[model samples]
Target: MAHKEPPSPLLLVRGNNRRVAILVISILSLLAMFFLTFSPHLAIRHCGHGEQQRSMATETMSFSSGNTNDGGVSRRQARFTDLNDLTATSQAARNEEHVLILTPLKNAEAYLPRYFEMVNRLQYPHHLISLGFLVSDTTDRTVQLLQDRADELLNRDPPDDDSSSNNTRYHSVSIFEKDFDFELPEDRRHEFEMQPLRRSFMARARNYLLSAALKDEHAWVLWLDVDVIDYPASILTDLQSIDVDVVVPNCLRQTDENESMGYDKNNWMETQQSLDMQKKLDPDYVLLEGYFEFLTGRYLMVDMPTHLGKLDKVPLDGVGATFTLVKAKVHREGANFPPFAFQHQVETEGFAKMAKAMGFGVYGLPSYLIYHIMNS
Candidate 1:
C-alpha cells in the first residue's frame, strides 16, 4: 500500500494553524459579548439590527394590524398589502397621508405621557399614521420619556387578534422629532401675558414643524398640544369625512370658575374692551370671527399642501395650532420651515396670513372635542 506516503508534515502544520484561527475568533467573540452586555449603541450596531430592524418591525406590525380591529372592535383579519407593495411617489405620500398628529410642546412633562397614550389607544390604525413631536430643548425628563415611549410603541404587539373585543385600530406608535427653535421666554407665552409679536417664537416652532412634516409628504398634519387629553379615537374619522383644508377639533376647557363651553371663534372682536373682557374671562382666549373653545396648539388638522398655500400668501391668524389638520402638498410648497422663522417677529404669522391669502378655509369640528389642560 506504499504506507500511504506517511501523512505530510505540512498538512499537520496547516491543521495547527486552523486551531489557532478558531481560538482567536472565539476570544474576539467573547470580547464582543462583554461590550454588548454593557453598551446599548455598541450592542445595536454590532448586532447589525438597530433602526433598520425596528423600522421593518414597524411596517410588519402595521401590515398585520390592518382591519384587525375595525373601529377598536375586534373583527376578522383582513387581507392587506405589505408596505413594500407601495409604488410611486404618490404612493409613499398616500401611505404617509394616513395622518400625522403633531403635538407642539415646551415644558410639558406632566402631560406628555397621557397625550401619547391617548394616541396609542386610538381606535384607528396607529401604525398608518406617524406622530410628529416638536419639543423644546426641555430641562426635565419629557424628551427622555418621549424617546422611551417611542421605543415601546415600536416594540408593542399588534392589536390583539381576538375577534370578540372591539379594540381594533391600535397598532404601534411612531414619533419623529424635528429641530425646535425655543428662543421665547415662558413668561411671554400667549397663556401668560399676550405679547403679540413676542409670542411668535411658538409660531415659528409650529411653522418649522409644518415644514418638516410636509417633507415626509404626509396627507394631513394634525396639530395638538401636549397638555390636552380628552381626544377620542373617532376624532380623525370625523375630520377625514370633511373635504376642508383645515379641521379644528373644538373642545371645552374646564375653567377655574367651573364652566365649560364651545372653543371656536363666534365673531372677530372690533374693540380692545371686548378683547380685554374675553381675556379676563380666559386669559389665553383670543376673540376671532368665532370663539373656539380650544385652539392653542391642542389639536388642529391640516391638509399639508393646501395649508402650505395659505402659509405662502400671508399669516393665518386666530386659528389654534392644536387639533388641526392640513394637506401635505400645500405644506411642501410653503418651503419647509424656512430659517429665521422663530424671530419673535412676523415670519411665522406671515406664513399663516399667506395661507389665508391663498384661499384655504379652516373648518371647526365641534363634534370632536379634546380636553385642554392649560399649564401655562
Candidate 2:
C-alpha cells in the first residue's frame, strides 16, 4: 500500500492546484466584506464629519444665582455671628465720632460732578465725615464719571489757603454702586427699575442704608440726593445746631417762568437756603399753608440722638433728599422713614409723621440751611 502512493507525480501537482484556487477565493471574500463594513465609517471619521454634525446643534441656557429675596432673612439662612455684638464692642472703643452721608443716584452723570464739587466745597469737618454713594443700574457714563471724580478726590491735596479757616478737614468719600435689580428677568426689568417711583420701594431702599449706616457706628447719618450742590461752609454749622429727634431744613425748587407772564412768569427756585430764608422772613413758615413761600431742597438736618421709630411708620411729603442728618444710634435701632417715596414724600411728610409718632418734635434749622444753587 505505501508503494502505491508514490506511483504518480501528476496526481500530486493537481492536488496542489486545487488547494491554491480555494485560498484565492477565500482572500477575495474577506476583502469584499472589509470594504462593505468599514468604508463609510472610515470616511466620516477621516473628514471629521461626526464632529461637524455635533457642532451644528444649537442650545441656549440661562442661569440665575444670587441674592433674590428682599424681604428678610430666609428659612435656610446661614448661622453667623451677630453684627450688633461687634458693633457694641466697637462703639465702646471708638474714639472719633464719624458721620455718614448716604447719597443715592441713578443716571445723574451730568448732575453728579456738580454735586461732588459742592460736597468738596463744604465747610464741614471733612475728617469726621464719610460719604457713601448708592448707585443703581446706570446705562450711561454716570458711574464712570463718578469713579473719575472719586479718583480726583482721592488724589486731591489739601488746599494751600483756608478761606474759611475752622477745624474743617477733608473726610473720606465712598462710592457704593449696587445692582439692586441686576438679575431681574427681561420682562420684569422695567417694573423693577421703576419701583423707585413708588413710595414703599423708596422707603425700603432708604431703610436698607440705615442698617448699613448703623453697623458702621456713624455718629450722624445724612441723606442726600445727587442733584444738589452744597453751600460753601454751611454743613458744619448746620450739623452743630440740631437738638431735636429730627430737623427739617427747607429746600428750593428753582423754576423758570416766561417774562411774558409778568411777575408770575419770573423764574424762581424754592431752595434749602430759601426755606431758611422764608423762616427768617417768617418764623412760622412750616405752620403756614399756601403761603407761597419756597422751601429749600438742598439741606435737611435730623437729630439722631432721639428715637428713629418714626421713620418706620411715617408718610413723607415732597421733601428734598439733600443735607439731612441723623444720629447713627437711632438708625441702628431700626428707626428710618419709609425710604421709597418717589422724589420727596419720605423726606417731607413721611419724615414729619415719623418724628411726631416717636413723641419727638421737628424743628427747622434755618441757620444751617446750605446755599443750594438752583440753576447751576
Identify the candidate with maximal TM-score: 1
**Per-model TM values vs. the true structure:** 0.53, 0.49
Span of 10 residues, lowest total lDDT, candidate 2? 258-267
Candidate 2: stretches off by over 4 Å: 1-96, 159-170, 180-197, 213-217, 230-232, 257-320, 339-348, 366-376
lDDT of 2 at 298: 31
Candidate 2 CA-lDDT value: 0.49
lDDT of 2 by residue, 1-376 (tens): 4565553534455766867867887999999999998897465333377765654332111222344453575433332332353221123114455667787666777787677667766555566677777666667787788788766665666566654543344366666666556433435523433333443444555665555544343666677667555454555444434434444444443345411111111112235564455445432123211223432443222211113322222212223345555555445554466653312334234554454555554444332333344441
| Model 2 residue 290 distance off true place after TM-score fit, in angstroms | 10
Q: What local distance difference test score does each model get?
A: 0.52, 0.49
State how far residue 93 of model 2 sits from its true place (Å).
20
Please, what are the lDDT tens digits per residue for candidate 1 over residues 1-376? 5566776544565757977867887999999998887686334333345777886566555654334655589765533444443222323323434666766666678887688667756655555666667676567776778888777666655556634433334233444454454556666554423444444555567765665554332466666667666777666655665656654655556677766544433201124444344444443322222214433222222212222322232122435555666665446456222223221113323344445556765455443456676444
